[model samples]
Target: MSAARPARLAVGVVSAGRVGAVLGAALSAIGHRVVATAAVSKASLHRAETLLPGVPVLPPDEVALHADLVLLAVPDDVLPGMVRGLAAAGAFRPGQILVHTAGAHGISVLEPAVEHGVLPLALHPVLTFTGRSEDVQRLTGACIAVTAREDDEVAWSVGEALVLELSAEPVRVPEQARPLYHAALAHGANHLVTLVRDCAELLQREVLVATSTGSTDESMVGSASSTSAERVIGPLLSAALDNALRHGDRALTGPVARGDVGTLRTHLRELDRVDPELADIYRVLARRTAHRAVAGGLLPDHAAAEVRATLEEHR
Candidate 1:
């Protein structure tokens, strides 16, 4: 039997932060009434104004008093304190849904509110937020990592129903696995931006070198901000990501995969001059990639040995 959905919620966001504001708007879209939210910063206020519109900006406690579902989308570090403070303040009541969006935490972090007969849920959307209206639209087709009390079927059902209302899929994450789940997502998504941008900057430097030496590289026209270079690089990155996803470790390619010691040495020399930090990053990633390639049988044993030796020598 399908578990019964919770009452039609009156939502309250503790603060109209990036994730909070967009999610508040999403709930509003799904026929929930967002009565109030707390927003202090100018950015948060702006986001609330844009996303929540006519919803009143109230104090956290007042917002809590007005809503049946309290969305606590604060930073991970701030969440425990916030929940304790709100509970101490008598802001939570019996049967209130206390949902936090911090990926690193589960319902244990909301334990303080459980004393007030509140239902705790960890509803973490496994996607990035830009605090824009577009983020509301982005919620569709997204995966939400839902962590609920294992013994409470009603809590799990309510969490999944909320996710479905926002047009997202729900993946159950056990309370014990929240930290590891969050770490994996952060390692993949956050570091990916750093990796991609660094590669683009490195390519921009090479393009500058080509142009300064009097070469007519039409592709090198315009600033790094220009789509000219992105046009050349973006498709390559997309294809590489697609291949990596579909084939996993077997998608190995490039100088590291080929075990081109000379090419790697040249790259290290150039990058060392360009950015010492980048050179260090490149060396570490190349070594790891080479290891994966060998493990996947993409690189021969001899090639893997040579690559390892080259990396160790450079280090």
Candidate 2:
């Protein structure tokens, strides 16, 4: 049996937030009709106007009443109450497909709407959104994690069908594993941004110190120096990322990995002088990196211990 209920189904976005607005546009591109959506904040309203032109901005219940497929793209914490409220309001109709995009949850969160006879599904896009037209194209080749109700073969197929409609790959994730899956992605992607920004800040300090003598002071470092620092790190960082992804622990090549205790001491002192918090971050990450390198056989145990001691004593 085909998973999609019908061709050209009317789609309703509960709120045209960043993920919602762009996905509404994507569906519209692939023969689905975005009949209506709910938008409250000024940014959401602007996003709807830009991405979902001609689609009516209706209330959540009204949008639900009008569509065959109701997409609930609100935050994770609010979804449960929102579903219960809509079910209580008689918004869900029998045979309507209810899908949510929260990564942390699966079909369990949509159980309230099941009473209204809606087919529940959890379809999470593994990529971030910018609420722009470009995101529609970026959806191509991206992976979407789907968790459907157990024993509901039809719903699982429907979820995959929807992902295929968007030109993305679908990976089935068991309901129990959703939280761990979400955590891994967040730890890698979200924390990478914070780590990169910290590295750029450190590089900026070096650039500032080099371009100006000690008399100039840190306050005088401007955007030009910041840009220069980023430019200097950009390609190097890009190659390092590529190598790390392709070669794994074999890509470990630095003072810590090489057991250069003197170099590690220098880095600790420099980071401490720049910012105490950053020095702590460095110590923590370096310790983790050395452990992983040793485990992977990239560094001997003795080398790792020496690196650890240098990091521990960098007072």
Clashing pairs in 1: none
Candidate 2 lDDT tens digits, 246-303? 9888888898888899989988888888799989988998999999799778889989
Task: State each model's CA lDDT, in order.
Answer: 0.89, 0.88
Candidate 2 weakest ten by summed lDDT: 218-227
Note each model's CA RMSD in angstroms.
2.4, 3.1
The local lDDT score (0 to 100) that residue 300 gets in candidate 1 is 89
TM-score of 1: 0.93
TM per candidate comes to 0.93, 0.92
lDDT of 1 at 301: 84
Error of 1 at 173 (Å): 0.7
Name the lDDT of candidate 1: 0.89
Best by TM-score: 1
Clashes of 1: 0
Off by over 4 Å in 2: 4-6, 212-227
> Model 2 reaches what TM-score against the true structure?
0.92
